[model samples]
Target: MGISEMRRTGEGIDERSNFIMYHKGEVAGHRGVGFLVKLNLKSQITGFEGISDRIAAIHIHLPNHSKNWTVIQVYSPTEQATRTDIDNFYNNLTEITEKYSENNLVIMGDFNAQVGARAPGEEQIIGKYGSGKRSENGKKLVTFLLENNLTILNSVFRKKPKSKWTWLSPDGKTRNEIDYILTNKVKEFSDTGIIQNLNFNTNHRMVRSCLCESGTKKPRPKAIQMNKTQISNEIWNPITAPEDLMTVATSDIDLKEKYNKIENKLKEQTRTDITKSQQTYLSEETIKLIEDRKNLITKKDKKENQKEISNLSKQIREKIRKDRIIKRNKTLENYISKTGGTKKALKELREQGKEWITKLKDKNRPTISRNKIQNIATDYYRSIYKEQNPNQTKTQLPAKQQNIYNINKIEDIPEILESEVEKSIKSQKMEKAPGPDKITNELIRGFQVNGQNRT
Candidate 1:
C-alpha cells in the first residue's frame, strides 16, 4: 500500500525488529516516532498502530503472563511547541493508553520534559529521587501519569543526581532527565538508569528499565544470532530510523547504491503492507491454566498454593504434549493434501533436494571449489551447444545477428510506461506462489486506486 496517503495521526507505531516508521509531514522530513521489537520477541507482538507522528503503541501477548503488555512509545513536542499542540499530545496519548488499560502498560521514550520530585499529590506517580526542577511540560506529563496510574520508573530507582539525566544540552552545561520509562508494574521493576556505554550517536543517554517479579531474575541481553561472515556483510539498517527512505534521482550515488536503496524500501513496504499474526499451538484453556500457575507461583503463601500449582503444572505439561502431537498430525495432513508439495516438503525434511552443497564434482575436474559450482551446469550446457554447432563459429554469424548481440547504453533502452506496469501485473498467474517480496498475483490484482490514493 502507498504510505503517502495514509492517515496523518491517531494510533501507535507498529513494532518489529524490522520497524514501523510513523511519518508526520507530507514531505520526507527528519522528525518522526517509532519503535522496534527484539528479534527473539517479535512473535509476542499482538498488534500496533501508528496514530500520529508523535505517538504509537505495540501490544505484546506473552503466554503464562498475568496480562499482555501495551508499550506506547512517544516523542512529546518540544517546549517551543504551542500550548494547544502540547495539550493535544497528552490528551491523545491518555486516550490511547486508556484504550489498552487491560494490558500491563508501559510508556517510554523522550517526554522532552523533567519531573523534579514527588509533590504532595504525586506520591504514587513519582518518587523522592526525581531528577531536577519540573518544567511546565514536566507537570503536564506528571498529571497525565497520575491520571493514568503510571509510575515514573526512573524516579523510583536510587541513582546519583549526575547519573539520572538522559539528555544533555548542546552547550554541555545542562543535563535533564527528559526521557523516561513509566509503567504501572512498579513492583516488578528491578532497576532503572541511564546507559552511556552504548554506541548510539545521539545527544541523549539511553534510559533502560529492568523489570521482573519479586523472585524473578534479570535475563542477559540477547546477542544477534549470526556468524562472523554475516556480521561483517551486514548493512547498517538501524531499527530507530524514522524518516522517509524513498529513493531519490540523484547523481551522487552509483547505480548499485540506488538499486540497493530501492530494493530495501520495497522490502520494508512488503513487510508492513502485509498482515502478520503469530500462531500459537496451545489452546486457550491450556494458556489460561499456565497463566493461573504463574500467578500462583508469585503468591506469598507458597505452601497453600503449592499443591494446586503442581496439579496445574502437570495438566499444562500434558496439554502441551497433546497439542504437539495434534500439531504434527495437522502438518502431515497439510503436506499430504498438497499433491506436488508433499514430495518437496518431505525432501526438505530429509535435506536431500536443492540443499546448498559446499562442494561440486566433475569427472575431469575430480573436485570443485565453491566458486566453481556454476561451472558444472555451464559445462554441460556448453557441451550440448558445442555438439549442436560442430561446424559453426562466432565469425560465421551474419552481420545482423552480430549487431543484435552488441552491448547497448542504458539510456537507449525504452522507458517502461505506467500502462506496461498495469499490464504486467494483470498478466501474472494468480495461482502461482508469491515472490521473494511476497507480492502474489492475487494481491497485485486486489490493488485499487481511489482518487489520488493507491490502495
Candidate 2:
C-alpha cells in the first residue's frame, strides 16, 4: 500500500535493499509521502518521485499489461491549514499528474475534505453517495478534480452511510468521508468501497477498489540447458591433446584445413550433448491451470475466480522459480567440472571484465534493426573511401624521394634474432584485438616452435 504524511527523513535509507522511500526534505521530517510496495511488486516499479511532502508518485509496469500505471498518494492539508500550503500541494500534484498523463493514473489518500452529496452540476465528478457536508477544502478538491478530469471513486460508489465514512472523531460523535480513491480512468475501476473491519490503529478506514485491466498473459520463454562439461570432455580434451597437436604440427595440411577439422568436431559434439540435455521445464499441469484461470477471468467471476487465479499464479511462479534454480545449479556444476574447480574465481573475473565491454557496446549501438545498421555502416564507409577525382592524372614521386625510400634493400636488412622475436611476441598485450588471421597474441605465444613453447 502507498502511504502519505509519513513524517520521516530519507537519509541513510537503503534504496537498493527493498522498502524504497522518497521524502521531500531531509531537515524537515514533519510530513513526507512515499510508497510501501510489497516484495513481489517492488520489481515492477519503473520510476518514482517525491513531488513534495504532500504528494508522492510511483510508476509501475504491471505484468501482462501494455501500459504502465502511475499511482500518486497525497496528504492534503485540512481546511484550517495555511492557504500557501494547500496551494503548493495542488501545484505539485498537478505537475506530477501532467508528467504521467499517458499512464493509467490512480490518486488516493486522506484529502481532509468531503464532496458531500453530489450537487446537480457536480454529477460528472462526484456521485450522490458522499457523507457529511462539503467544507471549503472540499470545494477546492472538487474544482481540482474537475480541472484534471478525475473522478472521485469513493463518492461515485453507493454504500451505507456507515461504510462511506472513512474517518471518525476522537469523541466518537463526528464522522466524515475525507479519505478517497480517485482515478482519471473511471471505467477501469469497476467497484469501490470502504473497508471498516480491518483496523490499523488509525482513524481512517481502508478504501478498496476493483480495477479491470485489459491484457493477455504471455508464456515464458523456454530455457535451453547445455551440458558444457560433456562437450568439453568428448570434444575439446581430445582436440587439444599432445598427440593431436603433434599430428597436426607434423602434417602438411593447410592451416584452414586444420581449423575446419577442429571446428566441425567441436560443433558436432556440442549439438549432440545439448540436444540430449534439452527438456521442457514448465509442466503440462501448470499450463492447464493457467488456461483455467484465464477462462474464469473471461467469465467475470470476480471474487472467488480472482482468488483462485491468484493462488494458481503463485503456484506457477514457485514452480518456475524452482526449475530455474535447478537449471542454474546444474549449469554451475558443469562449469566447475569443465574448469577443474577454478570456475568460481575465473567466472567472477570474466563476468566483471565483460560487463563493461557489453555495456559500452550496447550504449553505442543505435536502436535500429540489424539490417538497417549494417546498411548505414556500409553507406558511411563507401562514401568516405569514394574517389573524388577518378579521371585525374596520377602524379609520380621525385627521383631523389624514391631513392631515399629504397635505401633499405632486402639483402641489406639484418634477420631478426629468435630471442628478440620471442621477447616482442611476449611483450604484446593479450587483450589486444585479433589481426586479419583471427589469431590472438596469446595464441601465437602458446604455439610450440623448435620443440618449445614460444613464450
Candidate 3:
C-alpha cells in the first residue's frame, strides 16, 4: 500500500477533524451536526457497482462530511481486524449517539457475517447456544453485535419478503446473506421500517433506514470568524436555510479564484515596476547630498594620513639613534682589538676611548629638547601650507624659495597674504579678451591707396 494509505487511521481522522473545526465554526457546535454520505467505493468504480474488491474494512463518515466518524463497513482484511479496530468502532458509535440530542447515529454498510442461520440446532440462534455457525471469525462478529446491543434492521425488512440474498459471489452459485445495517441507538425506527434500494449492480444492495429523510437539506457549516469586521464584510450573515447554504458555498469558489488571479497580477506588476525604478537615475539634490558626505570623508582621511606621517617621521628618528649606538659599539671593539689584548694596554686604550664613548653616548641620549623645537617648526610649516592651499599636494607645491619658511611666525603669514593672492587671481581673469577690433576700420591697410593707384 502507498504511504498515504499506510498512515494510522486514527491520526488521519484527528487531523481532518481539526481542519474541519478550523474552517467551520459558527454552525452551532457539534450538537447539530449531520451526515451527507456516498459510500461503498471501489477503484474508479461508479454507480451501483461501486464495490469491486474482495474485502476491506468500511468507514462511516460523520455529519456534514467531516473527519470524525464511526466505522460502518464489514469484512475488513483479515489481518486488519484487530481488537483495537473493533473497539474504536464501538466507542465511536456510543460517542456519536451521546454527542447530539437528535438521533444521527447511522450504522450503514456491509457486514459479512450473518447473525443467525435458518435451520435450528444447525446454526447460531438469536438466544440459543450452538444455534449459529461455529466459524471462528463469525463468532467474533456475533460477539460484537451481542455486546454492543445493536439491532439488525435487515430482519425487519424481511417482513415484506424482499429478495432474500444481500450479496452474490462472482461464481453466482455460492451466495450467502452477509450485508446488513444495525443500530440500537436511534429510536422511532425498526428493522421492518428499513428500505432496500434496487440491486444497483454491486454484490450488496443499498439499504437505508426508513426513519431517515430521502436526503437531508441543511445549512453549510460557517467558516471560522477571522475577525468580526472582516467576517461581517466578507460574508452575508444570518444564513438560516439550505438555500442560503448553497448560495454561500457556491460564491466562495468563484471569489477564491478571483482573489488568486488578482494576487498573481499584482506580483507581476511589482516585478515590472521594480526594474524601472532601479534603472531611474538619482535626482540632483540626492547627488549633492552624496557629494557632501564624500567631502567630509575626504577631510577625515587627510587628518588621519597626516598623523600617520608624523608617527613615521618619529620612528625614523629613533631608528637613526639606534644606528649611531651600533656604530659606537663597533668602534669600541676595533679599539680593544688594536690594544694587543693585554689588560694594562686595554686599560690605557679604555682611558683614551672615554672621550669617544662620551661623544657617542651624547649622540644617542634621545635628544628631546633639540628635536622639540624642530617638531614645532615642522608643525607650523605644515599648518600654514595646508591653510594656504587646501587642495595642494607636496608634488604640486610651487618650488619658490620664499623667506617665509625661515620665519618663526609662519602660521600667521597665510592670513596676511591670502586676500592679496585672491585679488591678483581675480584681476588676471577680468582683463579684456585679446581679440583685435575690426572697426569696419581702414579697409585692411592695402598697399594701394583708395584712389586706385597701381603699384
Candidate 4:
C-alpha cells in the first residue's frame, strides 16, 4: 500500500515473494503484488497474470467444479496522489474486471479509499457498518464498485464500532475503513470482520471472511490397497527353477544366449524387489487421501486436509529410510560371505579403480570444454609415442657399460595362469566406467562366466 513504483526490468533481483508476478519472459523487481496462499491451496492454482506492479491475479479451479475462480489483489494510489495516477489505476482495474467478467471474481486489497456510511443511492453496494465520514477517494471507490456490480463485503457484515474500522491514524484519534474485500457473488461469503486480537506490526488491522460453496458434494477417489505380507514374501523367496546344464553346455549355442539366461533371472529379481519396496514404503490409503485433498477448493477444507497428508507423508518417508538401512545391511552381509574378509574386499576395490583416471586436470587451470580436453589428451599421447631418430647426435655410452646393460632377453615371459585371470575378472567392480574398447568391467566379468575370456 506504500508508494507504488515500477521495477526496472532485467535487474536480476532475487524473487523473495511467496508468489510473484512478472512480465512475460522478463523480471521486474519493483513494487509487485503476490498471493500468500496456504501450502494445500498451492496445487489448485491453474495460472497467474501480472498486469502491473500494483495489480496481479491467480486463477483457481478445483476438481469436480466446472466454474473457475479468479482472485485479483490490488493496491491503489492514495487520495493525495496526482489525478493522472488515479485515472490510470481505475483504467487498469476496469480492463481487468471486464476480461474476467464471466468467471467468479474476488477483488481484495488496500484501495487507500473508503465508502464511509451508506449513501442515499449506494444502498445495494455498501451496508450500515462503514466507519468515519466520506472523503474524495471514498466517492471514487464507491463509483468503481457500482460500475462493476460488486459489493463491499466489509460493510455488509455488522460489527462493533471499534471493530468496524480497518486503519487507525498515527495520533490514535482518527479511524477509517480504507481496506476492503469486494465480490461479485456476495451470497458466497457468510461473514466478514476485522480480527482485533491478531498482532500485525502495521496501522491496518487484518480482515478475514468465511466463504462456503453450498450444494457441492465432497467425493473421494477409489483406493488401490496392496498387501505388505504378500509383497515381502515375493521379494524374499528364492528362485527354485532347475538349471538346464546340458543345454548350456551345447557348443552350438552362442555366449549371448547363456548371458541372456542369467541376465533375465537377475532382471526379474530386481523388478520384484522394487515392487515390494514401493508397496511396503507407501500405503495405498495414504495415496488415496493425498488425491482427495488435492480436489478440495476452500481454504478451511485445504488446511484440514494438509495436516492429515503431512502426517501420512512423514510416515511413508520413515518407512523408506528403514528399508534403505535394511538393504544396506543385507548387501554388506553378502559381500562379507563372498569375499571371506575385509582384506580381500579392499584388494578387489583397489583393482576396480584401474579403469578410471586417478588424477584430474589442475583446479587452478582455466575451465575447458569436453572436446578441448579430449583433443589435448589425444595430442599429448600422440607426441609421446611418435618415432624419434635413433642415431641422433647424442652422447654415446661406454662399450663396457652398454654391453652390461644389454643382457639376454628371456625368450618367454611365463603365460598368465587361467586362475589368476579369473580372479582379476571377478574382482572388477560393476557399473564402473568403460575402457578404450567401450567395454565395462561388468561385461568383461560376464564373458568369464562360461570359461570364455575376452582380450
Candidate 5:
C-alpha cells in the first residue's frame, strides 16, 4: 500500500487504485509511499521533495491564490518500533512542517496515532468530535499540531463514532481514527469525515475533506457528508423475505413478477434509494440531493430552488470529478490487471485504436469479398449442425466419453459440516470482491450457520 496515495488514490497491500503513481519505498518496500495527482494539479506543482522513505512533500501554487500549498505526506513508525525510530520520525516531521509553516500547508497520511476527543487547552488544534483514547503517539500528534498551528480538520466536524474511525484492527475488535489531515488554514475546510463503503483495499476507512477558500468570514463548513455506514444504519431497513421466495420462480412470467417484487421491496426499504441518475459514479448521498432537487422543481419558491439547484449541480460535478480520479487504481492480485488479462479484457485495456479483426479468411475459395466472408462464415457454422430425430431418447456420446450425467460422483463427496462452513466464512479476508450473488465476503461472514453436518 502506498501511504502517499491514501488521500486521493487509496492505500493497501493489494492492487493500487490508480493508473498514475508517485511512490517512495521505505522499510524494505513494506512502507512504500506514493501519490496520484490529477493532470491539472500536477501541472501546478512548483516542487516536490522525497525527504525520506517515510515522508514526501508537494508544493502547489494555485492561480491568483495569494499563498501556495505545501502538502507534507508522512507515514510514522508503528507502535512496536524502537523509541529511537519513532523519535527520529517526529524530528524529521517537525523540520518539514517548520519549513512550510508559512505556506497554506496541509499534512496528511498515516500518523498511527489516536488524538481522541478535544482536550482542555487544544481548542485550536483538536475538536470535540475526535474518537478513541489518546495514545502516547496521539499526545505527540497533539503537541505537533499545536506547535505548528495546524488544525485536525476531521475532528472539527461532528460524525457518528462509527463513521469517525479510519482504521479497523485485524481482529475487528478495535476501530480508531489514526489517519488524518492537518491544515494551517482550518477555516477553508468545508467538510471532513470518514468516507465509508469506499473500496480502499485497506483496513483503514478512507477519510475525505473539502476545502473552499476566497471568502471574507471563514464560517465553519456546514456541508454534512454521508457515508455507507450512516446510510445503512439510519436509512436502509431490509424487508423480510418470503420463505418460498425462489420456489415459485419456475416460469418466465413467475420469475419476472418475483424479481419485480424483490426489486420493489429493496426500494421500499430505503424510501429515497430510487433514482434515475445518468452517472454511474453518483453516490447515495448525491442521489438523495438529486431527489431533493427534483422535488424543488415543482415548488413555488423559484428563487430558493434556483440557488439550491446551482449548488447541487456544482457539488454533483465535483463529486463526479473526484470519484473518477479515485476509480482508476488496480491491484496486481486481481483476476484482471494492467499487466495481465484474458484476450478480450486485454484487448480493451490495450486500446490499440482500431478494430482487432479487420478481415476474415475463406478456406474453400482463394477469392472472397467482405459480404462473401459473412456468407462463408454463416455456411460453415450451418454445416456443423443438423436436425436431430425428435423420437430419440437422449443425446448420444462416444464410448469413452459416455453421457455427462452417467459419470456423476455427487454421492461420493461428503456432506459439508456447518462448523466447517462457519470456519470458512470466519476465515474469509474482509473487503474481498463478492461472488455471483453480489453479496460481499464481509457480509457473508456476518451470517450464522445454524445446523450441523448431514448424518
Candidate 6:
C-alpha cells in the first residue's frame, strides 16, 4: 500500500480531535465560527483554517496529552515574495509555540535563499539570476535566523565539505543550495551536523535529521484512554454555604406566611357565609331561597378565582412594562449619542420638508419622453416661425442660424403652454406682488404720460 493507504488506516482521528480545549472553559474552536476542518490525504489527515488569512494547526502525533510535534503551516497561495519577505514572514515561528522540553524542534522548509554567496569570502551579487553571491535578500534571511537563535544546521560550514549543494535549477544553467534543516537544540542533529543531498525527482530535496543512533530509539509514551461518559462529580463545586443557609431561611418564612394567610382566609369566608344566611333567613318570605344561597356560593368562589387571576396578570404586566421602559430609555440614550435632543425637533421638520420637496418634484416630472417633447417643440417652433416670417424661403439664413431661430421660438412660446401651469401661474403672481395705489392728484400731475403709470 502507498503512504495514502497507511494514512487511511489511522483515520479514526477524524472526529476525535474536532473539539479541543484552549484555556479554561472559553467555549471556542467550533467549526466555521472561529475555525474550519480542512481535510487532506483523502479522509485521513485533518486540518483547520481561520477566517482571517493565516492558520496554524497542531496535530497530536502521540496518543494523549499535547506532547507532540505541531505543524505550523503558513499557506500563502497567491503570494510570490523575495527571499527577504519569506524570511521576515516565518521569523516569529516559535513565539507562541508551547515548547516541549524533551521533544524535538524540527524546522524544515523551502527557504528560497542560499546560506552564503561564493562560499563566504567573495563579492556578493544580489538579484542576478543564478549568481551564488550572498544577496541582500540572503542577509535578511540570515538576520532572521540569528534573531530567532535557531541554528542553520544544514550550513556547508557546519556540515561536511563535500555535501554543500542540495538543489539545482532544472535549466542546468543555475545551481545553488536553498532548502534548510534548522533546530534550536544541538542534539536534534546527532552531533555530526550532517547535511546530505537526496537526488529525488521533485522540486524539493528531502533533508532529514536524527536525534539518536539506530538502536537507541525515542521512548514511546503510554496511551491515555479517556472515558467520555465519566463526568466530574465536582463540576459544579463552589462556595455555597451562605447561599444554602439563605435559601433555607427564605423557604421556611414563605411557607409560614402562606399557611397563615390561607387559614385566615378560610375563617373570614365561613363568617361571611354565616352572616349572609342569617340575613336571608330573617326575610323568609322570599321565594327560591335555596337557589339564592347556591348563587351566592358560586359568585363568591368565582370572585376568589378572578381575584387571584387578576393579581397574576397584573404582576406579569408590571414586569413587562418595566422591561419596556428600560429598553425605551436605552434606545433614547443611543439616539442622544448620535443626535442630541436639542436638534430633534429641527431634524424632524427638516426631514419633513425634504420629503415634501422630493414628492413635489416627482409629481412635476414630465410624463412624456424627452424625444417626444423635442418633436412637439419643433412642430410648434415651425408654426411660430412661419407665422412671424410670412412669404420667406426656408433657406434664407445660414443652417446654424436657422436652427437657432427654431430654438428661439420654443423659448418665446407662451408660459401657459407647459404642463403644471398652475405652479407657473402662482410663481408669476408671486413675482408681481401688488404695490400701493398712487392715484393721488400730485402723483397724476408729476408723470404727464399718455400711457399707464410710470411712478
Residues 23-87, model 4: lDDT tens digits: 21124564445555544454565555566667766677755546787888777889899999888
Positional deviation of residue 199's Cα in model 4 after best superposition, in angstroms: 3.5
Stretches of candidate 6 off by over 4 Å are: 1-68, 71-88, 91-104, 117-133, 156-162, 191-200, 213-455
Off by over 4 Å in 5: 1-20, 213-455
CA lDDT of 38 in candidate 3?
26
- Candidate 1 per-residue C-alpha lDDT over 133-183 given as tens digits, one digit per residue, 9 for 90 to 100: 889898898789878888999988899886887776654467688888989
How close is every model to the real structure, measured as TM-score?
0.45, 0.47, 0.27, 0.45, 0.45, 0.28
- TM-score attained by model 6: 0.28
Write down the TM-score for model 4: 0.45
lDDT of each: 0.64, 0.67, 0.37, 0.62, 0.63, 0.38
Worst 10 residues of 4 by lDDT: 351-360
> Highest lDDT: which candidate?
2
Worst 10 residues of 2 by lDDT: 352-361
lDDT of 2 by residue, 21-67 (tens): 54443446576766666555655766555666778776788875677
How would you encode candidate 5's per-residue C-alpha lDDT over 1-455 as one tens digit per residue? 22543332222211122223455554553665666565535346555556677787767776646898888788888778899989898899999889778899888889898888887888899877776688999998888888888899888888877678877665546767889998988877788877654421245766777777564754656853445455455533122223223333344566678777654433333333422112265567767766666666446553445566566667767776665554333222242553365554333334223211213556744321334555767887887885677787986788766554566643476799978886777778854555544445533343222332111
After superposing candidate 2, which stretches have Cα over 4 Å from the reference? 11-29, 216-455
* Candidate 4 ranges with C-alpha deviation above 4 Å: 1-31, 63-65, 216-455
Instruction: Sum up the clashes in candidate 4.
Output: 0
Evaluated at residue 63, the lDDT of candidate 1 is 51
Winning candidate number (TM-score): 2
- The RMSD (Cα, Å) of candidate 3 is 43.7
In model 1, which runs have C-alpha deviations exceeding 4 angstroms? 1-27, 213-455
